[model samples]
Target: MNVARLMFFAFMAMSVSSVSFAQDADCEAVAGQRGECAEEAMKAAARVLNDRYEALIDRAGSRYIFQYQSRHEEHKAFLDRLKNSQRAWIMLRDSNCRLEGFENEWDKPSYSADLNRCTAKMSLERALYLDGILPAH
Candidate 1:
């Protein structure tokens, strides 16, 4: 039950549960323009993911300050681990999306759009997963 293994399981569960093909309004509106729509969606999703990540970091810091004030080393270790976990997750997401987008052909006109769509979907899911961690105030 290590952190990385737990994260993998969580990601797998999320991916399985999020198999719907229904596109959001923004994407659907630009159905004929997938590249533009998907790029926008990916940008928006990245913003949301960053916001959630920052919030979690803030929450962790506050907890450390108010609860683990005497355990500085422990808090630092947790932060370091968190940073590594996030980095690993980002790499996994990017690699997974690349594989998904280039499965048939890498030079296809829809490759960029497909990659963006995968990135956007995974980013949103990761954001939601972050939200589920650390209870809100």
Candidate 2:
């Protein structure tokens, strides 16, 4: 595989493993209160993810303004790609969580809790990854 594809897979593997570990730890910490805890965690992580995404979009827009006045096309292209990638990631995350939830009965509280935990874990990971790459003001 190409280096970029390999790296992407590696990162995904790490993210999945970390999410699993976090879910276990979170469940243990909450003493069998996974459902409520997962829901709360998912909401908090979503807030962080949205904030980071908006900040990055703002940064990207301002990045090319002063140093490269003639690069409007490039800025627009970057923004388009960023927005597309975020949309794709959200779809992927939802689908993956849905598939994972299939491990349990579809009508069970466990399934909902698992889905929420997965979403929370993935959102937090994505937010941390974005933080690492976001440009400084």
Candidate 3:
């Protein structure tokens, strides 16, 4: 109700609404910090893709009662691809972790163990790539 309280609430809302993982950083670093960026990317990508699909669905839904033509069938195809891509990306992110361990394969057990940190690093790099951000060789 008060200004301070309202501001606090607004901050909390913004914090909750804004995802913290999408940043411009090194993909290797993101992959190093979190093996799950692939997962996050998958989710984020799916959301973006799904939004597009949903829009089509809405238009098609107007034609059909519950099911969608361009929306439902098209999404089915997109969803399958998205799942496969997400899984592959996660695997790639996890596999990348091997490098973070000083190239020590024995350092980590599985990618899920440190996927979050690694994913964050990956997300940052992806953000850069999307922004035309390139890494120095």
lDDT of each: 0.76, 0.78, 0.46
What is the C-alpha lDDT profile of model 3 across 70-129, one tens digit per residue? 456655665566457556765876577545544334455344434444554554343322
Top lDDT hit: 2
Q: Which runs in model 2 stand beyond 4 Å of their true positions?
A: 1-27
Model 2 vs. true fold: TM: 0.73
C-alpha RMSD of each candidate structure in angstroms: 5.7, 5.1, 13.0
Per-residue error (Å), model 2, residue 9: 18
Q: After superposing candidate 1, which stretches have Cα over 4 Å from the reference?
A: 1-23
lDDT of 1 by residue, 1-137 (tens): 56775776677556534532434565777768867878877887788889989988877777776765756676787789889989999999999998998764557658888888889888888877776666444
List of clashing residue pairs for candidate 2: none
The 10-residue segment of model 3 with minimum total lDDT is 128-137
Of the two candidates 1 and 3, the one with more favorable TM-score, higher being better, is: 1
Compare candidates 1 and 3 on lDDT and give the better one.
1
Q: lDDT score, residue 34, model 1?
A: 68
State how far residue 56 of model 3 sits from its true place (Å). 13
